[model samples]
Target: MKKNKLEVIPLIDDFSQWLAEADKSDNTIKTYRAVLNQFHEWLLSEGMDLNHLKKKDVQQYITYLESQNKSLATVEKAFATISMFARFLKKLDVVQDIKRKQKDKKNQEAPDSLTLDECNHLLAEVKKRRQPS
Candidate 1:
């Protein structure tokens, strides 16, 4: 689909203007525009666009970001940009139900404890270092 078909680019431009008027930094405006552009491309690839945006669509986009191995911070930034855009369009409902995905327990788990042999080696080192104590 042509980028203009969804009219997203214009909205993004307008949104950037709004951000600037609201005293947003140049870097902040650039970041938000880049994120919205990326989201627009994703929507086009999915055979949809912002005009058809829905909560499920936003959720699926989040899933897509995770699938692409994007860092959690990147995904959250994208979500935040989209949310702000939705608010700009007076369509907050499109993303209101979406929630950021945290790393699963398996991903968040601490590193495995030291092995028994390693533990014994550490103890031996400590004992050797103990001078008259």
Candidate 2:
């Protein structure tokens, strides 16, 4: 079947502007643009309009990514990228709340690294460096 073209010229334009104004690093902006472009391609293939996207559509896209054997971390990053796009859309009043599910609480904990003593020592070192001679 011929894929329907989901008009994203305006979105691309707006995203470029937002990206320019954003405080994000160059790598971050590139990742966000890549993720948004992937979503745009999927929408066209599904014959869906950008303005008419639903939460279920996002869920299905996530599932599709999993089926392709993408790593959980990669999938999560894509979700975050898309969430930024959703926020941009909301800012333009093109859509309502389209926030993705939050990361599992179990996964949100910091990895074992610095201990309380280490943290305190690091803070002290920083303060020492800032002290006047």
Best by TM-score: 1
Relative to the true structure, how large is the alpha-carbon lDDT of every model?
0.86, 0.71
Candidate 1 collision pairs: none
Query: How well does candidate 1 score on lDDT at residue 119?
Result: 99
TM-scores of the models, in the given order?
0.71, 0.61
RMSD of 2: 6.9
Clashing pairs in 2: none
lDDT, residue 10, model 1: 71
lDDT of 1 at 129: 94
Give a tens-digit lDDT track for model 1, residues 7-112: 6667778899998998999999999998888888888888878766789889999999989999989999999998988887888998887867786779777998
Candidate 2 off by > 4 Å: 1-6, 91-133
Tell me the lDDT of model 1 at 11: 70
RMSD, every candidate, angstroms: 5.8, 6.9
Off by over 4 Å in 1: 1-6, 103-133
Per-residue accuracy of model 2 over 20-120 as CA lDDT, tens digit each? 79877778877877777787788777776556767766777787887888887878887776667777777323223434344579978899999999999
